[model samples]
Target chain A: MPQTKTQVLKIDKLSKDFGYRQVLKGVDMDLAAGELTLLLGKNGAGKSTLMKIISGLVLPSGGKISFKGQDTKKNPQNLRKSLGMISHQTMFYGDLTAEENLLFFSKLKKVSSPREKIEGALHRTGLRKFAQIPVKTFSSGMNKRLNIAKLMVMDPELLLLDEPYTGLDYDSIEFFNDYLAEFKKKGGTVLLITHQIDISFELCDKIAIMQNGVAASHMKTASYTYDDLIEEYQKR
Target chain B: MLNKILGIASIISIALVGYLVFFWAPIESSMGIVQKIMYIHVPSIWLTFLALFIAFLCSIGYLWKRAEIYDVVALCMVEIGVIFCGITLITGSIWAKPTWNTYWTWDARLTTTLILFLIFVGYLLLRKFMDYGEQQARFAAVVGIIGFLDVPLIHQSVTWWRTLHQPSTVFSTKKNVIDTPLLVMLLLSLLAFSFLLAFIASKRIELELKSRKFQKQIANLPQDHH
Candidate 1:
């Protein structure tokens, strides 16, 4: 059944090196349309590097990535148009308002008719009331929510979420969980990097554990137990 | 090995320039031995313009090619230009005290040259403080290109305005404006300074690359050892 789903992203033998240190050795993974895949790994397993490469922010030292069956190196416009990245880093103008931030990113993403979408995003993040104020004045948790709001208007096909729930309050995390469910229902593919494995087990359709800079195992969440995942994760 | 060769050659060329400037070139009727300052001052100005022009070109190349090499080269060139600009200002002020009767003046050419120096110094400071990744490189490229536009204006300030500084005689189209020996000595000084600039740039770029490698090593370090 997983194989029958339309494959949205394919990465084969991806490797990245920073000087003499090899961060990613040879990573191969697949994400299908409408599937929310949770990527689990211990710290410094090159999960963020893999996400950066997928989002076209960092070029890999070796290997290839295909988006919608097209080589990303040749057809980077496709990656730009379809990829939405959410990281802890909010690369927004501190002086700009929350609404202004979304509008700016929407324009960069070439989102048409972003007016209503911006409002919708602001409302979803529960920051509509604070949209008129500058982002520098907002709390850390508020900034994280605004990050989600920006991605909502991007209309991307594949979402790369890295530590999205790091600074969130309890209510915001619940809201994000529901938002992910809704996004999946709309046929959006997601590769989420998070350490909250128990909560993620209920949301992610499949779990991919990374070890030694490679995707060590992929298992169906429905068929695998918590103990099975821990056993496989500890194999590193 | 090549840098060592460049270093020795640069030292020899500079010694040759010092000999020609101090002993061979005829002294001006009015300025006397102080006229020798022109030999170093004029060439420093020329080398400053040359360095900034190269930085401008490399900045544009970085924007177009997205190559880290271009960024490194551009930053190095900017530093060289700033150093020469400082030399030009200091030597000009020293010359000014004896000839223009003051140590400093706000004339058109002097003001424009000072602005050029400030702009590139700002470029260096921006690189020093900011940069999460490639963002600083992009910002510096934009600043380098815009700041370099001040160079041509500084060159033409003498012609475009009534300035206290003397009009450029070395690059002038008129014949016999400067004595032939003086012009030759100035050209030789430029050649010597250029070799020195190139040598510094080569070493600076190599060190910068090593520093970036170290920074990447830190960035890729594990969040926790356990």
Candidate 2:
């Protein structure tokens, strides 16, 4: 069987359960290139589980997931190489300097010219000045910036962010939004899970509202109003 | 660079201790020249337990924080403990030949040391069965913590039970059993062996980290099919 072209990521009949509680039930979705898809729902909506499944951190109980027209089940590591993720965890050694952190991740990603790539990522994330400081001394916003820098070191085609704006101040959030705008301009794809409706409205190309493990509604930015999404979310 | 310097210093100290044990220290009149083996035997046994204790600490740290470096440190310590255990066994056997009129004995200290060696072997074998990355780390940490529990048992078995073997004299401050020259030789050998243990552990950890990096690269290759 042949595959479609527009789908960068495809999840079909995906269900996950922990013991007797089914967190996701027959969840289906498709993400296309150059699209910033915002996944929104209340707490315990299985947003993180879905993201983890796509990132190859966790396997679904029942589902088929494809990345770039390749079956993720058979080739998860290869598929994972193309993904960059930012979660609540910093995922870097606190004692290492920001540059060292970036270098280590770049090495893990097998990037050629790791030093140059790390330097470029630091510059892009506006973390060049603090590159020599240990991450333990960094503020939460600064650490988030370094986390973004580490992700960029991989040059991943698919970027996954789970509550990336959770602890950021207004200025930091604005800075992150500007960075995402530029990231999308360069034909990058993003799957972001957040509860912040205002940021979703301003930044996302499409909004996917997940409830009880299924994507209840997926609409383009022009198709759904803020009130419409809120109503749909509450109704579920 | 720091490791290389430390390695050189350990080698020099070990050479000095070797000279002191062979030529400078006095031989006991009771057991004759065989008693001189205490300089090597006691230090090796002490170092083996020390390495295992460090492994235990590192395993606890790894489990508490899930840090990869702590896992590496624990793994390195296990290998060092095994090497020191082998040395302890060899030196003990050498001393046994002249004193006990045999190459081996079923004494409590000897039996416990043998069991400790078996546990160290089992730890390495368990590590071999595990796959790479976090799973390998977690499995190794569990094994390390369990394997280290044997060290204390090995140390206490001589005192706790009536055995033909002598009790531990490594930490004793008695003046009658060991004279000043033999004591100094044992202390110097202990210091040298501990330094050597740290040096080898550091090198092993570096190699382990490099191997993990290589494995990750191999996993990422497009043509290498899983």
Identify the candidate with maximal lDDT.
1
Query: Which TM-score value belongs to model 1?
Result: 0.75
The regions of model 2 sitting more than 4 angstroms off are A1-5, B1-226
TM-score of each: 0.75, 0.51
lDDT of each: 0.83, 0.79
True contacts kept of 1: 0.00
Kindly list the per-residue Cα lDDT of model 1 for residues B7-49, writing each as its tens digit.
Answer: 8889999999888887788887666787789877888888888
Structure candidate 1, residue pairs in collision = none
Residue A195 lDDT in candidate 2: 71
Compute the DockQ of candidate 2.
0.02
Best by TM-score: 1
* Tens digit of per-residue lDDT, candidate 1, span A1-236: 44578988999999887544677889888888889888989887889988999888888878999999999999999888887888878778899988888888888877889989999889888999999999999888998888888778887889999998888898999988898888898889999999877767777877777777778336474677877877877886
Candidate 1 docking class: incorrect
